[model samples]
Target: MGFEDLEPIFGEPKVEWDQGQDSVKLRPFLFHVSASDPSHLRIHVTDFHSNTWEAVKSVVQLEDMRDNIGIGGSWSEFVDYVIASIKSEDLKLVMEGHSSSGGAAYAKLVGQKLKGMPLISIPLTKLLDAAASEAMANLSLELFKAFKNMQHSLVEEQEQTFQLTKVISAEKERNETIQSQLDYYSKRQKFQKKNATDKADVSSTPMSNGLQNSPDKLKAQEASSTKVVNRVVPAYRRAKVRGAFLQDAEDAKDS
Candidate 1:
């Protein structure tokens, strides 16, 4: 809750505007005090930032020229006063906050200590009760809205987490496939190196050693030729060649 949040507690409070400052009128709050007598009470919205706690105040209007009165606190506290007045059966007890501070208190007490006076208690009591109920309703709505927003956030978070897990699993599978391919290629390279080295050594040997004209030598050469014709590439080398052929085919398709 911030500064504007005070509206629920204080109704709608506005900064006091000085008439001398501008002719335009903007009124949301008002406060006054009366002190025609010592027994009387009063309150006012003074330089609040500089002042200290004081008494309830009520301003004197023309009709009530009858002196001596009391007032205090701002209208924000008025509802409490009204409620208290109704409950305690005494208006003077809750005169601090109201539209007209001392007026509200005097209106409640006038008939009690004076004759031929009418009591105006019903209206104030009803107004205060209605205001309190409205404030409660507003608070409940705010809470419900907050709960809905929190639920939405939780659902969104769960969806995001599920998506992340799918991505991670896909990457794991891709890495495993790449590792398998690397192992296959590595074995093929080793087989190719060994075969090439053995062929080179055979080629460097003397072909005509004197035994070349012998019948056994002729048989050996014939066997050797047959072996070469029947020789098969290692499984690793065959697989490597097949992979290369497939890659080439894919590249051709793209072109």
Candidate 2:
């Protein structure tokens, strides 16, 4: 149907309504209905510029039939239309006025149908009475922001501490492993050195002879045994000293 035909159904307003006169005016209008204000006849004016952000999109931008619905391609209608795109695509007699427009926008934000929901507006435009209630709200918001920041910092510190602890533990374990390996190698080296010294002492000494003709041999043998004992005992003592040093190093690492 043409625009003229759909006008009467959507409250056909005069194209040139003269003030204080019944002259035809081109002002737009919408049908208002509410149980509380059944007899309220509020004329919808399309020329009232929307001060809200929703006043940018054209109604006909999304749907073709939007222009025919008497909203006059207003962005408010487009916003309400986008919101109602969830469900109830039909613009019922229920949708009307600035309050209803706000309701529609909120419903879309919450993704729920909240018809006739009581709005509790906490106006921050003025600090009327600074009571505990007022201070609590302000303090709560600030504390929450502070707590979030502190919690983030604390978590980072904890992570760094845990990493440091892990590194220290790994180092201690490495030191222990090195000490164990050192002990094994030191003992092996000490045993090998003692064996070599003993072999050398035996080769250097003369063979045993009869006691009647063996004074020189006896003296040589005695010297060789003393030399062997001297060589082996020093290596053993050195091995013990190295073990003590390694133990001290390990204890220092633990500390």
Candidate 3:
């Protein structure tokens, strides 16, 4: 089958016309399938950079698949198997170079060349699937941690509120107790003042009542007191009178 036959399986390919090399390149053609590393699939078709052969021969290089293409299976079956194998395994990639000392030397010389090239070639569908899964996993973990932190913060806030409520309640009760004591003392003070006023009124009542009931008797006593204070006694009278009893006795003796 031609490279065009692979279009239905691998989708449209990007074509590169190399004018200098006079060879047309089509990608992403199946290049290699790793026996050990299933995810390490490579998609590149390499041939001599010449245009002498037919286009089919140049583009579809069967020699490249001699190792991986099974003896009895078709190309479609082999491609399907490679895709299935990659999906079933975890996503990873591996790279290899030509087994030559010059290859190592050349790699060292060109250390940063093609630095960002992907080591493995997977279908776009598989790559997107893997990326989506990893993103979801990371997002889920972050959400879980955030939820736990929110729960902890909520609990702490509630505890603080409870404590504040208790303090407020205690203060309110204490204020009420102080107000009760002040009210009681205020009432007692008012009662004591009223009692002292009543006693004064009672002590002055009897004298006021007696004056009102018997004003004449009080005036008489006042008059008597004034007479005694103003009264004067006369001095004794001088009197020399002979006793009649002495004369009687003398007459009797002469007889």
What do the candidate models score in CA lDDT, each in turn? 0.41, 0.38, 0.41
Candidates ranked by lDDT, best first?
Answer: 1, 3, 2
- Candidate 2 structure quality by residue, lDDT tens digits, 1-255: 111211111222222222333432223322211111222211121212221111112223323434443345565444344343322222321111223332111101111123542211110111122442343343345446667888999999999999999999999999999999999999999999999999998787655435436788779878999898877445545645344434577788999
Q: Write one digit per residue (lDDT tens) for candidate 3, span 1-255.
A: 323323211111222332342242332211222221222232322111211011112213333442333323675554454344333323222212322321111111001112342222332212123443443344345446667888999999999999999999999999999999999999999999999999998887778677757979788889999999987754455343566444578798998
**Per-model TM-score versus the true fold:** 0.33, 0.31, 0.34
In model 3, the clashing pairs are none
Model 2 stretches with alpha carbons more than 4 Å out:
1-135, 208-255
Cα deviation of 57, candidate 1, in Å: 22
lDDT at residue 173 of model 1 (Cα atoms) = 99
64-162 per-residue lDDT for model 1 (tens digits): 322222324553343334323322322232122223321121111211223332332221121233443443444345546656788999899999999
Candidate 1 Cα errors over 4 Å, as ranges: 1-128, 208-255
Mind sharing the TM-score for model 2? Answer: 0.31
Higher-lDDT candidate of 1 and 3 = 1
The number of clashing residue pairs in each candidate reads: 17, 8, 0
Task: Assess the local accuracy of residue 142 in candidate 3 as a C-alpha lDDT between 0 and 100.
Answer: 48
**Best-performing candidate as measured by lDDT:** 1
